[model samples]
Target: MDCDSKTFTYIWEVNLDEFDRVSNLYSPPFSSWNGSVEEPWQLQFYPHGKMSIASSCLALFIVHRKLHHVEMDYTLMLINQKDENETLSVDKHSTFENSEDGFGPGPCIDDDRLDSPPSEGIYDPDRGFLVDGKIKIGVRIPTDPIPIKRKVDNMVSFTWDLSLDRYKAVPNEEDLLSPKFQTINNGEKNTWQIQVYPNGVVPELEGFLSLFLVHRGKDAITTQFEISLVNQDPTKSYRYTMEDTFSHDLNGWGEREVIGRRYLTNNTGFVFGDNVRFEVRIPLDDVSINKLEKEQAIVPFVWEVPLADMTSPTGEYLLSPKFMTWNSDESDTWQIQLFPNGIKSEKKQFVAAYLVHRGVKKVDTSFSLFISNQNEENTETVTMENVKFKYDLHGWGANAMVKRSDLEDPEKGFLFDGKKIKIGVQLATDHIPLKKTDSVMVPYTWEVKVEDLKLGTGKYLLSPNITTWNGQNKETWQVQLYPNGLSTEDNKQVSLFIAHRGDNEVTSRWSVSVVNKDPKKTESRTGTNLFGYDLQGWGSRTFIQGSKLRDESEGFIFDGKVKIGVELPSDNITLSIDNECPVIKEAPACEKCPAVVDSPVTKATPAGNPYDSPRPSPAGNPYGSPRPSPAPINASLHNLYRELKLKTPDGSEFSINHIMSFESIEKLISNLMRLSGSSSNYQPSISSYKHID
Candidate 1:
């Protein structure tokens, strides 16, 4: 349920004014104390709407103030603080690349080219949707790197029903200067005015009409809004719009270039029935109050350690020595290690790990181990977050730390490509008090991701090669399974084997399993034993008895393929994550850094066979080195072969010292019984295709 511990939260609050007429606006970047989208982040509000449906609903957006790239997982909300139930939100995972200036998700505006202005939302001011005359929007980011399709969004009270013709410019110069036709526009926090000079106030264009927008707010403050003018007659109802930002030396924006005397005097709707109308929109992107952000300055303390594949191999299944980190405080050290196989003593049958404290002195802290898989498709990507590895004597870990099953699953990135991998450690001290404002939680989180190289799964024709242990990739073997009985039904017997296909003797602690397909019948068998590669091929003839296999009631047969699985014991490790671990800076200081002889990448053997390696073959293993193929082996086969008592005639002939294999003895007895006309061992023959079952 919860995403791994590598997660944090960020909250953004936006307050908008003149919510009805304002098309949209963006707030100043939120300072660090509040929250940051990795950097300064601003909120964009659309009183009218956003995106495709701007005509129907109001919307909010996020904008990055800097021209850098970022990926974020966000949850945005439009909350009616007065009425908690009237909250709206959108969740999205967005990535923003560097823009010439700022990269922002717009309010229906094309950043590259403007084909049109922002579309308007259904705003009706008379319905009273504002809470204390302001709209508040909130955004929360959960995943750090991380949508509303709802019918209930049709609720009313957020728009304006008031007509645009309520206010107008007078017909004459004398009246235009009158107090009745001219007034100030009131905003939630500041005030501004529009002055119409029938007689140009500036001498340059005396005969032309002049319009000026003025901001009477504070000197250092800035305000952005939209203004429009309309000729009310049905024949001339189109309105020309202008978006404006006013502050400091720039008090307003407008000019006489807006119209010609002929266009205005034409009975010609300009003075249609003697009235001029206009609309002003000032969206509230943030609260009206000006804010002063305090300074934030503190570099986090971070440490890095490379997990080299030394001193341990995948085949070594018992616990190994712990890897130590240099102590940051010189008080206590942290220890860590991996168990390629599962830790059997604890019944933990998966890759296990731990974080332990080694020094006598302890400290208080927490850490997150990032076993990162750079491969996007890898499921083994790990972020073990917020581990409180105590400064106490012992440590915390197990094979279950990174579930063994997940490691073995190809899709799970854990070690699907067993290679040289990097394990990251992030440390964070307890809450540290600040000199000025509140305390800060300083964490040493790494910017780099988890990355690893892989050892190959060898190539083979008749057998499939698999690598069980990932460390140094030494313990690799081969295996192939026969779903149905290997031979025809008449003498059908499920077979499993360990082939001697490589150069050296392959030693394995293995398991063979056969599951009954029918849940109701529920019959199965699991056998485990130690195996050593000797002859050409070794293992069992009866991994599952043919008689018990075809029993319709309790047979092991499932679909067309009989399920046979093979597993072997891996290795173990004992380590811990100490809150006070020192950073491993040099290889010489840490004695555990093994002297490694890197193995050359083994190329797929030229088509022939792995057993055809150029190396000389050892005695009985006529093949090169005695390498074993990976297949389930029946333990009883080895024990049965040990009781051999062969009879060789005293002649100059070949060696005949061997025990009767169950299959051979059964065939001989079956023939004798058939000659006697007995029905005990009779069986119907099967097709080759069916034999593959």
Candidate 2:
């Protein structure tokens, strides 16, 4: 194929200040040609670098947005604004299939080089790539498209014969292993084997024959192949065809019941002189092995709270600084709330910790929390997998993170230098969704016209409901206008409120205006609030003076008609989670524990809202107080027990004498299994057994 030798250049003027503020910046789409076809392409620039290179270098990628596949040679350059001859550049060749596939010229420049002074580097305020708070980036791409590389198929086949009498002589529950064989797939040599069970391995399929093809390669492989039980007559063979990927965790795939043993033994045509043949055919063209890709591991966020902070005479809970799950704009922010003296029933006996969502939208996440130890190997951890956090259900936690007595024990190492405690949380980064780059704000305005204003009967007038989109959710809102001030306002001023008609919580910036004959004289009150079930609406009680609004000379009641307008930023408004009341409940006491008093321990209450007030005695349950509900299962203990099952080979049950960590349980089980001479594959079908007094 002839290459299109023409070269095209594209220039992007980047503002350093804006680049520093955003994680990624994109250039306008440009056109490129693959052979005779033209396709659209764009550039993606990462300010703090991408993935593992973050904060260390600047990265750039060529993105192809069209379906056309293209291969081209390109050069990325960072122009030195002061001296054009000193530009830094790198050349690369890549193949892009679609928008999801992109290639970069590695790290275009080091961060230090871009931030140093002119004497040390080229990126200085007076003389380098970044001059006047801006830099120039350019890319040159050759229109010539490289020919696609083709791979040849290495088709290979293997056949083996088994003695039917020998298979029948073996135990029905035992698997007969075949000798290892070798084959070539896509230019790579691989080993394989076959396993046959005359009678099914599982108890559920006792009279059936099972067959499996196992790959013995060191790496995971994907292949398309066919396996067959050759019959006396060629066309009558039983064939199984499939395409699958096999990894170390699951190295084999086949049918549990390939054929009924009774049928096979009874049929004369199936076996030749007490021998059966099995054949495997694989076309290597479609076979491929998994290749390792560059990835950034999720680093856990750690917070250290002073021991004094938790045990202060003033009972104030500790709140961690807000943090993002990932180093990207789309990442959600989260916070940790720690109650030194646990709330409700566990109060004074345990330490409680909760994970709070501080983001604008809902997110599905799996996360783990850990309490650090002086020796890292002894740290304690609890995990919550596949949980959703939204506006209403914004926080989740364990009421009994650790017993107060155990935490205060000096030898536990939970308290560092007996001064502070370290806590860490790691979020499953893959589960977080990428937020949209462009956020558009839509405005909702409602105008209520009142004729014969003074003749209005009710204390407040309601406007028709308007439906609009708030971020990704739809919400309905209405305007409440009081012609005469609320009774609490002594009827001296008019009142206006923006009521959320929907059931869900919504955050918005709103304004209520009393329209006048002239726009300049319009009187308006503006405020921002999170409207939800706890607080349905928010507004100003003293919106406007009643006399001024009623006077014709004031131009407020023009032509005997009053106009009231309510404006709400409909879209792009952040939906904040409400933290008015703690969303935790008292847990039931363990039946074996001794009875404890329900009266709260006396402590200095921080002078704040009623929500933070000390818990009252059980006998004095006041009205409007948070109701007592069942608390969540102890995550740390549940996680440890869930992975263990203790049952002997003879079906006898066993139980641990005391509570232990998952590692301890695993080690004990391993030793037990070893001493019992049990098969590694033996999985006991019994509940997690524990004996705690």
Candidate 3:
């Protein structure tokens, strides 16, 4: 290979910002050639410090080998150098411009001690200035040295937006001498150190590189180093205690390293200092290298801060290596940004009381809607009264008086449906009520039915605070049975009897039962009305005090006669008896009535029997005045009329007859006679009767 013949050539040049701005702009070349093409092309510089040079022919030849066209770009930067020390003058437009005002280098560099500008120097690129090689500029050749295989005419000399050439690296080799960082704990100094290293074979390249370190959890603590040196400088270092907060920048250098300590205010026992590290190399000062591959470093060493170490007033929290894990299942590490425990709240409704009717107007029921915890083991019922309308309502009496009337019977309304009322609960002992954020409402359906109304339309919503009364008073009725001097196979077959008129036969049957002296029970049966009055049976007859007891035996019959009359303006009554007792006439006069007669006497006032006639009394009364009849038949008759049973849909028996014992018949009839007078206020539709058994 003719090393002298292979001159430095200009490869493609692009703006650093433009390279980043248009990364996916042009498509990759369709093909590249390895045949007859030199690898590892050379780079050169002009004598002037502002301009640089490279092998334009070599770049063109390789590009022509693979591509049909090529373009050139360049950058004009103020470069200063003294011996090997060089500084690029950036933002130097002020130096390039004539000061309109009296001041020169306007705000070029401030008086701040930390921001002083570097010392100025000069270089002439035309004086054999070389870049990584000897650039034989202005060399004569048999063939054109600057390749003409492609258009180089419209190429810019250099502009505000400039691009610099790139020397493509030889194939089959990686840029192994990449800048990288490693953290080291120097136990001798009891201090943490960050070391920069060149990983590949050519780690000693002369260029620029930067080392950056940021406090992982604490943004305040950070540091950086920008080295324009050839390789890592072990002497250049940064240190901080656990109490301080910081961050920094990397100037320019290749293969750099960075490390920072756990920031502290007063370094007490500061161990395992907290920090993250990153390093990158700068191959060129042009915008392309400054951008496209510039700062090409992994954002590695994210401090895996442990959640357990997250505490208040944190001075130093060294994360355990074993505790490093991702925030989510897929992510490698949790982001350190502040995350909020998202708190949310919602409103829940509760009802308190229902409106009840008084005559016509609605009044608040004294009853309170009771809420009992479903988990009764842990909680109890809570009763609330005076539940007014929600505060949002303007008026005071709105909820106090008004309730949504049930649709079924708006006339007599009901409020809430029967469910939905729930009690709020708190854990017992140290138990805290579930926070609003921690709890949720459980949906429930409520239903209500009103008694006096038709079904299907009377339902309403029952809020947690409101409930309906479920219990009610039971409807009741009663009946009484009498043994009526009759016997069945067991004992006396009590006669089935009804006294109260409105009582249903079925309900009355359940109310009363007949038991003999032995207290054993017996069933009642239906019977006929013997006297065609209150008492009804073949063996027992019913009669008023004034009505004659009639005989029923067929052959041995007796014709009886009796007359009853009430005294004027009083309940006193007199009875005149004229009986035809044939048996008494033929029985030898009955020997002074045998004291208390036991034998079967004539059931009637027999004809022509002198003993059967009422004799004149010295007391002036055969029957007592209706002495405020304890068993007033007329009052019962009135009750019977009012209490008369209306027929129910289902078949059941009922009666309107006034019921009493035979012994009370006299008093009952007299009371009835008094009640029938003009002064009597008891006016019943049913005729009064003296019940006899």
Highest TM-score model number? 2
Q: Lowest summed lDDT over 10 consecutive residues: which window, candidate 2?
A: 610-619
Candidate 2, residues 1-693, lDDT tens digits: the string is 123557777878877665565877778777655432345667777655566554434477777754324677888777777788877778888887544566774334454543332233445556567777777776888764422223325556666566564454344566765655555565787767666776776868776777777888668887766666666645335555556777863277666666666555425355765556777766654544221111224557788888777773223356676555542213455677787887555365778787776532446677788788898887878899778886411667777788767777879878888878998787644333322221332334434344423423124554545555665776766555556644432345565566665346666655566777865466654444566542155554455677888788888765556776655554656423222111111222223221121212122111111111111111111111211111111334343331234655466566764455656766677678867787766543333444331
State each candidate's clash count.
Answer: 49, 0, 55
lDDT of 1 at 584: 16
> On a 0 to 100 scale, what is the lDDT of residue 178 in model 3?
20
Off by over 4 Å in 1: 1-22, 31-38, 50-53, 99-129, 143-693
Model 3: how far residue 339 lies from native, Å: 14
- Candidate 3 C-alpha lDDT tens digits along 203-311: 3421211222222222232122222111121211121111122332321222232111112112322111121222222112122212211222222111222223333
- What ranking of all candidate models by lDDT puts the best one first? 2, 1, 3
Best of the two (1, 2) by TM-score = 2
Q: What order do you get sorting by TM-score, best first?
A: 2, 1, 3
Clash count, candidate 2 = 0
